[model samples]
Target: MKVFFVTLGCKVNQYESEAMQKLFEASGYVRADEISEADVVVVNTCTVTAVSSQKSRQMIRRAAGANQNSIVAVVGCYAQSEPEVVAAIDGVDVVVGTKDRTRIVELVEAAISMRNEELGIRNEQPLSVVGTVDEIRDFEELPHAPQRTRAFLKIEDGCNNFCAYCIIPYVRGRVRSRSLESIRDECLKLKAAGFKEIVLTGIHVGTYGRDLRCQVSGVSGQKISLVDAVKTVLDAANPLRLRLGSLEPVELTDELIELIKTDERICNHVHLPLQSGSDEILKAMHRPYTTKNFAELTARLVDEIPEISIGTDLIVGFPGETDENFAETLEFIQSQPFAKIHVFPYSARAGTVAATLPNQIPSSTKKIRTNSALEISRDKSKIFVERLIGRTVEIIAETSTDGLVDGLTKNYVRVYLPDENIPLGEVVKVRVEKIFHDGVWGDYVD
Candidate 1:
């Protein structure tokens, strides 16, 4: 059988899609290049925002339209939150939630067989239901080795931080961490598989071991932290580079900062989301930290790791945010030494508390604020890249196309070099020559 996958959302989703692909491949199923030719289709959906959910629905319909005979499966956050909505769609044969993804191959096969058997009897069969995310307890670790040059290893799943504007915790359920032994084993396997870089991903990676016995093991031997998990991976796998995903500000302890500072393998890059830089707006959004706290943390990180690339997420036009609040946010972001900023226009989903909040900014105002934020982000990014000129950094060659080999530096700079017969996945040192577009033009060094 042949399968086509449509993956949406964050890196965690991408990792899960790859894992599912590996599972199908192991069962003698080949991957179809397009939905039109596939025997089965899997749509790994995202519900981060209403837009994401809409796209998920569109992709599901498109997949079904492309191949009416195919067994269409819709899974992930969208399915977890609204399985009934997905099942109501015409061509979805199976609806699997955030949980039970490991058994997707079996479910898809069974779905195909069941649908075929019942096709002659009736054309209005209900879709098969897998498990719901609410009952999810253990972290479902994917047992497949990653195939890419840079592997995203999900060490944790779900989130307990129910921010007012987020539907993630509702759809993803509670925090569940993978065991230390499992992490070590996976790290070893990925390293053995020749992946040079490993990016640790999760719904909320900062609270990695909060639910486990190692949550408070500093003075004792009982608790484990995200720092401990990183150390374990580094010690066991010793990958050339280790990168972390988005981290909560509250979780960035002095010890964690120190570990990143001293550890040579850990990339000197951090993506800390500062949703709304104004304290008033932050409170309205139910974000625990204040603008002052965020500023101090960024200052401390810059002071400790001078060359570190700091990135952030910003939400413009959030509820209760006035013109003054937006101005304060701009001022606060300008003061920080951020290398890149992911600016998002406030998107109020149906179930989020912020959706019902007063003083919701209009779409035009949101766009204006978003544009201004993007301008500031571009300036900051330019400054960061300019600072890299004449400096040599290590990069993993990701792809080569059109006589140019493109790769990302340790500090997350997208560097491009002229095609030099450089092998993909091989780490090479490049000296930055000039800033090109959002990245830099670099020449390979021996």
Candidate 2:
């Protein structure tokens, strides 16, 4: 049998899809390059925004229609959040959610058997294995190995902070951390697989150990923090470079900062999401930190790690965001030492507090703000790249096309080299030459 996968959403979702692929492959199934050629089609979904959910639905329908005889399976956050909605879609045979993905192959096999028994007749109801996310306590460990230069190891799952604009907590459940030993094992495997970099990813990575107690002999009732997980990955994998997923500003403790500063293997880039710069809008969104707190954290990071690249997520056009509020946000982001900005117009998800709040910003206004923020982001990115000119940086060559190799530096700068002979997946030094398309062009050094 051949299996084709359509993956969407965050890195965590991608990791899960990769794990499911391994399971199917291990069970003697070949991977199908085209959806139409597969015996089974799996659609791993995302619901971070309404747009994402719509895209998930479209992909599921497309996959289902691609091969008439294929067993269609839908999984991940979108499925978890709205199982019935997904099951109602035509040609869907199996519907699993954020939980119980380890059994996905078995579920697909059973669905396939049922389809064959019925002479390829569609089942009256899809096989749904979704459970309440809030009740989940332990992290589900899925077997995965890197197929690329950089491997993403998910050390945590779920979220506790119900940010007013987010639907993630409801779909992903509370914080469930993977055991340190499990992390070590995965790191060892990645190291043995010869991956140059390992990125620690999670729904809320900074909240990694919030739900677990320490297992050390001397430490009693002490909670394991993200710092411990980082230490474990460093000790076990010792990869050429290590990178962190998006982190909450409040959870970036002093100890973690110190570790990032002292550890040479750890990348000098941090994605601390400052959802909104306006304190009023932030409070309305129920984000815990104030603009003052976020400013201080970024300042400290810059003061200590002078060469660090700081990136952020900004949500503009929140409910009740006046002109003054937006001006404050624009001024604040400009004053900061941000290397990049990911701008999103406020998307009010259903079942969230912000959705029902008064004075919702109009779509036209949101569009205007989004474009303005994007302009700033482009300018900031160009400035950051300009600073890298004539400097040598290490990059793991990731892709090659038309005699040019593309890669990313540890600090998250995209560098393109002219020589395609630069081995993919190997760290090579490159001297920044000039700015290219969306990144910088660099000449391979040594």
Candidate 3:
């Protein structure tokens, strides 16, 4: 049997798709390069915004239409939250949500063998959040283990924050982390698989290891906290740098700051999500941390690690977010001068508190705010890249692009070195010469 996996949304979704691919390979299913050729095509969906949901629906129709009789399946966040909505469409044969991720291979097989109308799986499973932080499963060993320069190591899953404007907590359930033992073992496996960089991702990475929330750090040799899990892995690791995905500002403890500062293998980049910088909007969003604390944390991180490139996500036009509140967020972004800004205009999600809230901003205003933020983003990014001129950075070459070998700096900067000899997934020192709003160009030194 041939199967195709179509993925969308965040790193967690990507990891889940990879896991499903592993499941299919185990069941004697070969991966098909094209959706038309595959007997079963799975559309891993993301519904963060109305646009995303629309795009997913379009994919479902396209896949189903491409091959008239092909069994089209939908899974992940979108499928979990709105399975009936997806199934009501013509193409989708099976709809599995976030919980039964490993069951895709079987479900696909069953769909092909027995044609049944299992349309609505929405809210069919347990309403209570289900997952374990201690029992970590790294499906990296499955066949076709992501052949790439950068690998995603999912150390954790799910979210507990329940941010008002977000639906991930509802779709992904509560926080669950992979075991410490599994993490180290997987790191070794990725290293052996020729992956130079590993990005640790989850819904709410800050809540990692909350089940037990305590462990004896080998580096400390003391009964320490769970926050040191990354540190412990770093201490034992000989692999290249490990980068972190989006982290909540509230989760940046003193211990974590110290770990990044001391550990050479830890990347110098941090992706901190500041949904909104205005305290009023933040409170409305039910975010745990205040803007004051977030600013203070940013200052401390920069002060301790001078070369750190701090990236963040910001939401504009949130429900009840007044002009003054939006102004506050813009001003804060300017003050912080983040290396990169992932700007999003707030989109009301169904079954979320913000959906029914008063003072919903017009879609026009949302676009305006998003555009303004993006202009600032370009300027700030250019300024950050310009500062790297004449400095040599350790960059892992990803691939050759337009006659220049492109890669990422240890700080997550896209760097282009003028050498093709440097193999993909191999780290090399490159001296940066010019900076563009898009990326940095450099000459490879080592």
The whole-model lDDT of each prediction reads 0.88, 0.91, 0.77
Q: Predictions ranked by TM-score, top down?
A: 2, 1, 3
Q: Taking the tens digit of each residue's C-alpha lDDT, what string does model 3 give over 94-212? A: 77777766666766666665553334322222112223222343322322365457788777777777789888777777766666777777766775675667777777777777753
TM for candidate 3 is: 0.89
- Candidate 1 lDDT over 67-137, as tens digits, reads 77888888899988888888888888888888888888888887777777886331355455655566677
lDDT of 2 by residue, 306-328 (tens): 58999999999989999899989
**Number of clashes in model 3?**
0
RMSD of 2: 1.3
Q: For model 1, which pairs clash?
A: 214-223, 214-224, 215-223
Residue 241, candidate 2: alpha-carbon lDDT? 90
Structure candidate 3, residue pairs in collision: none
Best by TM-score: 2
* Candidate achieving the largest lDDT: 2
RMSD of each: 2.2, 1.3, 4.7
Tell me model 2's lDDT, rounded to 2 decimals: 0.91
